[model samples]
Target: MSKILDKLKVVELTTFVAAPTTGRMLADWGADVVKVEPLEGDFFRGYGKGLNVPADTGENPLFDMYNSGKKSLALNLKTEEGMAVLHDLLKDADVFITNNRTKALKKMGIDYDSLKQKHPRLIYATITGFGDKGPLADAPGFDTVAFWGSSGALVDLSIETGNSYPLNTPAAVGDVASGTNLFGAIMAALYARELNGKGDKVTVSLYGSAVWSMSFMNVIAQEKYGYKYPKKRYEVNPTAAPYRTKDNEWIMLTILDHDRYFPSLCEIIGRPELSRDPKFIDKIALLNMDNRKELMQILEDAFNKKDAHEWHLLLTQKDIVHDILKHFKDISTSEQAMANNYMSEFAFPNGQKAMLAKPSLQSDNLGEIENFRGPYLGEQSISVLDRLSYSKAKIEELLSKGIIKQ
Candidate 1:
């Protein structure tokens, strides 16, 4: 039998990363997701930062990841005729998602109040800059403000300090978090619908999601710690962080479980005497030594005695927390990811190979799928309209009037 979501339908009216990425995950789960786009299509079509693929003769890698396994229809919601098409589709849509501004949606009559009149059971989920009813609600949001700066995650890491090594986390921090918001809201709304016999409007914003994620830091700062990024964070954790081996290779060795592993670390480094030293004897005391120069200098010299690979094997056997600091290529070719089916080859529009996240499934229950890449602009407009029971003549008229793209 098909999975739980196989019989569901999702109407994705989103662009860019956050919202569309959530919709894509639903599509991968066997939902009949129809990606509604503007005439120009969703803006993420070229977000690959020059890593574009010419799929179906179109260059949109972001579109590929975010819209695969979904049908598409291009409609100009600003037009009366186009709104009619949306109304017709709403008659059967199980979930409707959009990332447009709240004011614009209300004006267009696509807001929850308006749509609920037509489809009372449709799950409505949305994303915004701040929120629909906050002072900063209308402020335009980008990934940077919402994810990096607002979250205070970057600030806590002390990334800006000149002495720190490579810092920034990958992109889509807020987007990823907000996507989680969308997914959770959808799940909860689905639950509510079963109980109340109606769907509800669920909303999340960049700022809200960022705030939710930074709760721990906020609590610590407000209560016990005067939270501030250290002037030189590496100066504090240098012994446990990456250091250049003799061959100029970076390696990280963390043996901070002082009472348990300090003796073993000392034996491994041939420094059996350091464990008995008063300066290094007290675990809590040394941690507050206020100066890690001695610790850093000793570890640096000890690590330099061997190359990264050699140290990796020796430390690993002793159960000492250590790593050679591998790169993305190392993980991509990793046997574990393949054995677990977390990553797999995807066929791009150009018939080239690409990496894509595997669909969620129990390993034994999964079956083959037609994993087509994303569509061109309005690629299935005519066919999609026909399926909606629109007459050919009326569809042509709407296209001619530019209410819907052909």
Candidate 2:
């Protein structure tokens, strides 16, 4: 089957999650992606080791998640020969993706300005900790610091825990989100290039992406609106908070139209009289902080009388907007996720099986894309150099000089 980006060629110079995620998505969509790594390989290759997974086992799922379906060409960009080889690859490339810091990028002479002069039609896409310009532009940024901490997600989300300690974000959550955002920008740039015969630079920062993600809450958090973050559960809308059931399982309710569902909820919980009480009769009454707190306590007590499964059935019958909280492991067997091909099962070369997630976007023209393993260090070095019309002897010399690896 023909892929959406079959004609696109991408050269990725990245480490860790963010930039590689964009390349992986592009590759999954049928673009030819060449991942350029250093002679020592991308540091991310060893990330599995930190998690107690053997990196040499050819089943580094964490690394594979972002680097899969792309060719690897290990090159020492510090060397002139290596830089020349990279330029050769970029000469016909449609896109260049990177997560390297701005200072390092400039030192390597692969910064947007340098590459733009050489590859005018190339889409230069970059992901950073902060933005491309700022005092901290060259500072190291990871999702934990840039996305969660600096963007106020860490503190805001800690409200549920009373802010005794900041919550630790899941691995690469921010990076993945930022990378996905960059992918959309790249698509837009691609369309623009098609019309104007010129490529553009696209930049996405982890901090910026996190702030955008928090915009819904941030917009209403101004003093003028009398809103604040780190709000207590009782201070929030009672109908919208999570409650523990009799079985100790948690379920979240999203009853935005509180007045419409108040009566039904009251009856379902055997508190029908409460709905008629003047103190909790309507949404306007619930707006009073004391009334809201009292309602929250009442609902909490009611939910605690029923098991999660029982509540699920009751809520579904009434068409109430709610869902049981699920752990990450539960998603693998989720019927909806499986039916939509959101979760996929794959076997590594060593026969180890794992469930992986597919891209969220679906297409009528193309169905599911096939899953593939990521490349080993320099796995495609020889073939890529040969494709670039390098003489066999020249390739050998470069390899001997440690300029390239295979």
Which candidate should be chosen as best, given lDDT against the real structure? 2
RMSD of model 1 against the true structure: 3.1
User: Model 1: how far is 121 from its true place, Å?
Assistant: 1.1
lDDT of 2 by residue, 1-406 (tens): 7999999999999999989999999998889999999999999998888889756545878788888799999999988899999999999899999998888889888899888977889999999999978798878899999998887777776766533567778789899999999999999999999999998999999989988998987888877886777777788888888999999999898887867887888889988898789888877887899999999999999999999999999988888999999999999889998888888898887888888887787777766865688899999999999989999999999999999999
Model 2 TM-score is: 0.97
For all candidates in order, the CA lDDT equals 0.74, 0.89
TM per prediction: 0.87, 0.97
Q: Native-vs-model 1 lDDT?
A: 0.74
- After superposing candidate 1 on the true structure, give the runs of residues whose Cα lies further than 4 Å from its correct spot: 49-59, 159-169, 231-234, 238-240, 254-256, 281-283, 289-291, 328-331, 358-372
Top candidate by TM-score: 2
lDDT by residue (269-378, candidate 1, tens digit) is 89988778776765654655353657667888888988888888878878888777778667657677677776667766556676665433342453543345777778
Instruction: Give per-residue lDDT, candidate 1, residue 171.
Output: 66
Q: Which ten residues in a row have the lowest lDDT in candidate 2?
A: 156-165
How many pairs of residues collide in each model?
0, 0
